[model samples]
Target: MKRIIFFGLLFSFLGLKAQEQATISGELKKWHKVTLDFVGPEVSESDEFNPFFNYRLNVNFTHSESGKSYMVPGYFAADGDAANSSATSGQVWRVHFAPDEVGVWAYEVQFRKGKWVAVSDRDTPGVSGEFMDGAKGQFMIEASDKTGRDFRAKGRLDYVGGQYLQFQETKDYFLKQGPDAPENFLSYVDFDGTFHNDGHKDHLVKKWEAHLVDWKEGDPTWQGGKGKAIIGAMNYLAEKKLNSVSFLTMNIVGDDQNVFPYVDYDTYDRFDVSKLDQWEILFEHADRLGLFLHFKTMEMENQGLLDHGGVGAYTKLYYRELIARYSHHLALNWNMCEENGDWVKNHKTPPQFKYERLSMAGYFHDHDPYQHHIVIHNGNMFEDILGSNSMYTGLSIQTHHEDFHLVHPWVIEWRNKSVEAGKPWAIAVDEPGDAQHSLMPDKDDPSHDVARKNALWGGMMAGAWGLEWYFGYKHDHSDLTCEDYRSRDAFWDQCVIALDFFNSLPFWEMQPADQLIDNGNYVFAKPGEIYVVYFKTGEKSKLDLSAAQGELEGRWFNPRSGDYLKKTIKVKGGSSVELTGPKKDDDQDWTLLLTKK
Candidate 1:
């Protein structure tokens, strides 16, 4: 009886194994054709590019029989690793599988040694088994229409060598640094210029203008209504060592340097000038006070400039004029739009919008006489284009709770690709949303820790440019008065707390991880000898990182309390360590600073 039962159980297990071994049949997807749109200053519209260029392409696929799912191998020829890989950085040929199967799958197409190929092994040690694993359960090789009835994936092959490394030329060309540049110009720490409290606003403006604020058109009275307002804002920023400001669309009105936009062309002309005199005064002030300026360029949502031909036209034209206009002034970055491109692409047809915006980017880069660090302020995470086969600058997303976690893997992927390309990359959370909004913008809220840290830690772990926090336009201006907008003085203090934490780390000593250590729960970064691990939830949590490194020494720093405790930390070789921080309920949660001697 026992033997019969044992045989029955063995046969049952075998039956399950047989069910899991289903093979998906489908034709290998191929490239339909190549499409490229070079959007320069002269070219306002889109066109076609002749292809069949000399480059390698790889096709990747995965599927399951049980209508469940599994992760198809990621494209990994360049870096030569798959499991701890991302599809964003390399040449991604998105396989459009027909949704004939009930399960899930992911396919990545990449270029390798001038030829396109496919693989299904993502793990470095190359492990393949049943598709029951959750991480590997997202792929199903069925139907997909990336370009219409196309069963295969399509992407252009790009030179993995020095040919593509020249995008750095664009960075250098656009962001050339003058001797007078601020200390942390590239750090991107800045003030909100739209505070409603006239006094606070004036304080901030004057504080910075005392040394900064170079302009090309209109007069921004440093002593008038505008001047007073600017002064308040600058003074506040200077008090805290925060000296850069990216003005929203409100910085200009036609030709005037006021806080609002012009009602018409006449209103705009009131402040208009071929040379912005007001900006000069402000620039001179900024220079004296040592402040940096980065105009948000234009607001795509409220102004509808892309279609109107005025504001958008002015944006492109102004960048050209401003670059030459303020070439001597130290500007930190050319922030393309206030979440314009993402909004359009996601809400509209992505392919069309992406192509159109790419043209705008090209135009901006080509026109800028001074090398500027250009960035796209994406309204959502779905539009991160830094991973495209073609080269572009880094990207930033306005993360609200709506999809905070949704962006981590993507960010990690882009970082990997950027590292391979040898280009500096960054992503920041610019919109924490609002209290009334579904995403909730409370920086002090503990519930938001998972979401916020997901963005901040993700960026840090992935070797991003830096992390940024937005306090909403309404909250920023709620304290409007004759003086600068109500002072969020303490708010800035907290910001410093966060930034100071970032400054303590070896900024240049890190790079994105080629792979992630999966502990069944949390993901960590292995930068050199340190295991930078981040836990998504729980107040006090301990992790077994013995699988991370052998004979590791550790110390932990409390980011919130500025407390550094040195204790002999250990995770035996091939084992993990157990550590803890405040519980999720503790608003005063902490960050563990792990290091080795």
Candidate 2:
């Protein structure tokens, strides 16, 4: 509170407003990020680009069309020349804005210069910086016409108090299918402050040379044609029908120190604009290719590794920069921390650490202009953090054990708990199986029978929002070092089948009902209108569809082959129906669908 007050007191001494006016830069498209440059008092990077203190500039934008308003904090761009040139000295300061509305939007700027470590408001007797204190500007935004794989066409995906994420514009519920392998997935050579020859936390080294062929004609590249391999990796995933990928934006003290936005390994505040600029290109391509970016902020060991604890000045600066630059993206979520259980050493009390994490989430939730979904990877401990008042909106879980059977009960438990707390949480099995041997390559375990039954079908059948495959330590590509996405070639087909099955049905309308199943199988139905059941045992059993009214048409779906029986089976209303086992035998997994006829 003292710190907040100190910053708030320095606003009164701000110098008289100068005649200079501010200008808006970049394209002005609805749902696009815009930069407003404030050319004022000259300040250079050598003078300390540290935004923790001294001076601060903030901006507020209001939509003229609908009267919507968004107030966001700003940062000094170190000459505002970092993107094109490395000039460390200049008079330009900038703020980024992403307008969600069309038509015209007006903005106001407030800049303060002080000798203190923190400054805000206009109360100090020593406030300075005359040129930008009262500047304002207006820009026009237009609708987007992009379609097909472009996620912008669908608009922002938000947590609308349900068990699933819904697109803001199209109102379509999303189910994610993609790779969660290679936790160090962002250690690309083309990125800033990265080394390709480095090894993962497991000490396994990979050059990612095998994925070079996957880089297509139109994929983006950086550092003057050096990003083909990394960008190509994304191309392959999109081609495989997968739509999401998880990677750490910063793991300086963890598995891979090769991926971060800093100018060096230790510095966290001065971001390398050129390197980050290249990243924006790839992310933009991912956007057009229809990919959901799951940004894992901090790994297990480094949760409290910062200068101050989790909610320190460094934390605030990092989150602010990330939100300002990338929050315009439509499909993505911020994983506050990955495996966030090892920070107990940093706090005087264990529970205090938990509150600190929650505090960070709360801070992010309140500041992020778009309010993107915020979740944290867990150590299976989410008791005090499951209520509607909490900042978390989903679950990013990690488990031990090869079969994903754990996913079913866990997701069901969290969903049930979140619902009981008045806000249903979107659950995704981020990392399943133990750290030793998680999801193996298709070449090693081509069938993937156990995984499909548990992690894929089990979680979804019990109401999960998404699933990402994790590679085990025993494989050629462990969770940290794996580069070739095609290593699990055959497993992708199974993922497609699961996602397709759900997409074909109005899954958003279906509710999980374990009572509707007579056998040990799973049941997802609208109660009376539609019934879809998963038969993991593939044994001939009776399904109690008696509560369902009217006659229904039934069919058998082959989970492995992605094929369904065309012929309809009769299911009379208010009566139990007998289901036959799959012709392939007891080892197979099959699904049954019955629609009112």
Compare the candidates by TM-score and give the number of the best one.
2
Model 1: which ten-residue window has the lowest total lDDT? 38-47
RMSD of each: 24.9, 6.4
TM-score of each: 0.51, 0.89
List the global CA lDDT of all models.
0.37, 0.75
TM-score of 1: 0.51
Tens digits of lDDT, candidate 2, 235-349? 8889889999888888877776777766667676666655666666778788888899998888776777664455776777677667766777889999988888755644344
lDDT of 1 at 95: 16
At residue 524, give the lDDT of candidate 2. 86
For candidate 1, lDDT tens digit of each residue in 54-131?
121222334444433212121111111111221112221111222223344443333222111111112221222112
| Model 1 misplaced regions, further than 4 Å | 1-229, 249-271, 287-292, 302-315, 342-355, 380-391, 402-410, 413-424, 434-462, 473-487, 511-528, 535-550, 566-568, 582-588
Question: Cα lDDT for residue 542, model 2?
Answer: 79
User: Could you say which candidate leads in lDDT?
Assistant: 2
